[model samples]
Target: MEQDTNQNKVSKADSIRVKLYWRMAVMLLVIIVGILAMLAVIVTQGWSVYKRQSAWALASQKQAVWGLVNDARFKLEEVSNMQTELQVNLDPVFGSYIGAGSDFDQLKDRFGKNKGQFNASLKEIETQIKALRGTNGDFAKLGAAVRRDFNQYDRDTNKLLNAGDSGEDAVPYEQIEQDMVRTKKSLSALKARLDQERKAMGEVKALTIEDMARTLSILVGVIVVVIAALILISMFMIQNFTANMIKPLHESVRHARALAAGDLTRKLNFQPNRIITENSEIGSLCLSLQSMSEHLNAMLRQVDGSTQRVNLTSKEIRTSSR
Candidate 1:
């Protein structure tokens, strides 16, 4: 009984040691998992924010490009309107049929107020239009003619200004009309190219945003799966170790109580019980407990023998006295 009790105590102590290791392992696992989860969340959030910022930047770029295209188109339209007005002014110059006397004066006044803006638009339109026309067979002649017409118009305006005759428009009205028509065609072609570029840019921005969204979603999914897998693996490992450790402790407790109540047949039952032979701490403990159980068993045997001898000696004395 004493042997069993000593073995149970040692077994309980070993079980407690295993339990402590398992608990520490579980705590470490939890800490590691928590840190990993936090890192994943931080990474996901950072990626999400970066994606959103990229999308916003792309949108802003698209807006800026579209604005530029619109501004170019608006300037082209303004040039077209100016060409029309020039064509209207040419009528009186060609036919000598001046209808609205104040119209020419008013046109001159308007031109003076907007001359800088008009000249800048015309310069930009001329450059873009010439580039679109390219180096073709007949474009050279057309280009020469356009330059001559523009120069003549400038010279005539100067002459009229020097003469102080607001009524005398000196532009060759018929030739100017033809030049305006050609220029309008060129402007229209350039506008078409700008429109095409704007469309392409818009498509690129849309595709980029869509791709980013898909990638972000995939990243989020991967993160969630990884985190869940870690949690499950940690739980499984901890549970397996804890169960193995707790079992020995419960058995040792039951056996100890039985031995304390005088059951000598009680034994320390360890599951998957194998002899520990290593020189490690747990192995040493098991060896020590086995030795203690053997010593206790020998002591109990000696006590039993001593008690029997005493009983026999007392009976002999009583018999003699009788």
Candidate 2:
């Protein structure tokens, strides 16, 4: 009755083999999700970096400022050429010798031509000035200053031309020279600003590329760390699963070998083992080994009892014969 009660106390385990398969499936799912997540980040971040590098964003910056820099440069060149031609035409008209002589028609012709060309050049310069004033803040202010100085010089030049070849009331060329000096300084400031802005744009583009590289490097590092962690976890789980499944079978085998050698000792028959209450296939195997040991021990005990009785009866019969 005690043995039967003890047998009833042991609960059977469901198959652990199936649990092992499930664990493998879960690991595979984790790997797949990790891959997909990494791919998603790569695609999204790479596209964002590509756009930032110089696509639509840089194009808009060029349209707003960089293109104007080139335009201003070309216009400045045209202004220089026109100013040189104007100076060349007007230089002789202001000569004292020409005023004292009768080359008056030649002087008039040169003045008229210079005046007409200056008007055309002034129109183009005004357009350029408007663009300069509307763009960069410092650049605009410097351009305005340069324009004012050039205007002073132009006003004096026009006065000298209108009073052509007159020995009397002409502003000294030195006064006009001072205005051009100031104009040169202001134009230098404007050019310096353009150069600075272009340099800044180059630095910004380089920094943007560095930032993109840093962001991608960090992403790659994180992915590698996570994958390495998963691999360690998988190895640990595989080790644990293998131990749990294999150890019990080995213990059961040892018990069976002992029973086969006919060693029906208390250790094999009554000792507790993993087979007693396991919940998996190994548990069933342990239970079978325990049952076989139990039945054999019972049969061996009965045979010993009958053999003792027979020996006692034979001694009694020999005494009766005596």
Residue lDDT tens for model 2, 215-275: 7896888699779978987998788777766676677777878767867753432333332
Those runs of model 1 whose alpha carbons end farther than 4 Å from true positions after fitting are: 1-102, 112-186, 205-209, 269-289, 304-322
- Please list the C-alpha lDDT of all candidates, in the order they appear: 0.54, 0.61
Measured with C-alpha atoms, the lDDT of residue 265 in candidate 2 is: 58
Could you tell me the lDDT of residue 52 within candidate 2? 67
TM-score of each: 0.55, 0.56
In model 1, residue pairs whose N, Cα or C atoms come closer than 3 Å (at least 3 residues apart or on different chains), thus clashing, are none
